[model samples]
Target: MFIRTENPQTFIKFYPVTVAILVLQIAIWTIYLLPLPSVQMWSNLMTGFNLGIAKGEWWRFLTPIFIHASFSHLLFNSFSLFLFAPALERMLGKVRFFLIYIGSGLVGNIGTYLIMPLEYMHVGSSGAIFGLFGVYVYMVLFRTDLIDRANSQILLTILVISLLMTLINQQVNMIAHIFGLFGGLAFAPLLLNKKSDGF
Candidate 1:
């Protein structure tokens, strides 16, 4: 399910939302890498700073979903989205997928703001990517019609590995990963209740 079978032309046309998100992430990361002071300042401003959120900079929650701490961070998330997101986008349609994507990220950031120390700060789309995992989990467990047994098993294995990695990776925001996952599970039923188009 995670494989990229679609060629560039078809992928762009079929999964515009996923493509757009990948483009936005890369563009923002590119600007963030610039040596200019203004770019650095802007990048700093966009991170998920718990103190900044407490200071009423609420946009930090949303903006951090697109920002990454390093080229590897951006590339990993972008590649994950490129490979895995298109299926959900195809199944859920553009609008609902976008809502889940952003909403899950917000849930992660808000959870971080509420739980983390005021001095804490973070950036990356791991929360959002994990949110996608949650959605797939929901499918594996409840919405069996959406995914076959073989694919479900594969997803479960990946999910286990992912959670293990999240725990092992000291740099990752554990709260955001956990919260974003629940966020996706929380959003799944409501969003998936309606009939979705099969990919």
Candidate 2:
């Protein structure tokens, strides 16, 4: 179910929300990478800095979801979003899917704000992507009817590997990952209720 088979010519026709998000992420990353003083300053201002948030730069929480530290960072998150998000977008429809994605990212950022040190700085969509996994986790555990066995197993394997990587990687913001997961899970019941029949 996670595998994407959408035709390139019509991908945006079917999944406009997912395509829009991908475009936004890439555009933001491009702006960040450009060798321009104004854009560099904007990128710095958008990073998830605990001190900045604490000082009332509240938009930091939302902007960081589209910011990435490097090409690999953008590629990994963007690829993950591309591969997995369309299913949820199609299942949940555009508005609910957008809410879950952004909500989970917000939860991750707010959790980071509360837990991390003032000097801590982070930029990526890992938290939001993990939130998508959390929705899949909810399906595997409680909404089995919404997911088949093979997909469940595959998601479980990925989840385990992701958790292992998160634990092993010293540079990862483990707090955001954990919180983003729970955030997706927390949003699942409300957003997913009565929708299984539709899917």
Candidate 3:
């Protein structure tokens, strides 16, 4: 529910929105790729839902999206963004795309903080990535003609596979993924341009 197509001129002007996020991620990784003296790189600066929240670090909720656990983690999520985010920007306008991206990820973090084991620390953009998938699925269901039917089906399959794989991987934060999906469903109302029932 996060985006509506805008004028081509606006799209061109805002195209850098997605690029800016990518650049920030890359820049952070570039400087903090290796572990430091006490911080273990910049992770202490960036964490998902963790005991840090209890410590009164409220920023913990949204900060983890930028603190990826490993190169592969960042790589896959970044590639996914590269594939999905650009189209979303074009469709929903850059501002709305950002709303969906960050908002869904925040929901995932909140879910992890309240529901998951406090000892486990999560770090990655997978939650946000799943949120993007949720939006795409919603589009396929209600706005089928707005996107390619076949591609939508393919993306859905990919989502399922990713979920199943995560189930097998103990390191992945399944709680965050699930919450992010719910976030997408909840956010659908804002994505729509019409006055009709958002569902």
Among all candidates shown, the one with the greatest lDDT: 2
Error of 3 at 141 (Å): 2.0
lDDT of 1: 0.88
List model 3 lDDT by residue over 1-199, tens digit each.
2343657666446667777787788777776755666555356757764787988888989888877777888898888777677767667766777888898899999999988877768877778878888877787777765667667767788888988988999888898898887787667657745532222
What is candidate 1's lDDT per residue for 1-199, written digit by digit as tens? 6788888999999999999999998998877767899998998889899999899999999999998888887887888788779999988889999999999999999999999999999998888888998998988778887888888888888889989989999999999999999999999998985566432
Residue pairs with colliding backbones in model 3 are 1-191, 2-191, 3-92, 4-92
Clashing pairs in 2: none
Model 1 CA lDDT for position 140? 79
Which lDDT values do the candidates have, in the order given? 0.88, 0.89, 0.76
Off by over 4 Å in 1: 197-199
**Candidate 2: tens digits of C-alpha lDDT, residues 1-199:** 7777878767898788889989998998877777999998998899999999989999999999988888888898888899888889888888989999999999999999999999999989889989999999999889988888888899999999999999999988899999999999999988985656422
Ranking by TM-score: 1, 2, 3
Q: Candidate 3, which ten residues in sequence have the lowest lDDT sum?
A: 190-199
Mark the regions of model 3 whose C-alpha exceeds 4 Å error after superposition.
1-14, 34-42, 195-199
Score candidate 3 by lDDT. Answer: 0.76
* Residue 73 miss distance in model 2 (angstroms): 0.5
Poorest lDDT segment (10 consecutive residues) of candidate 1: 190-199
* Model 2 alpha-carbon drift over 4 Å, by segment: 197-199
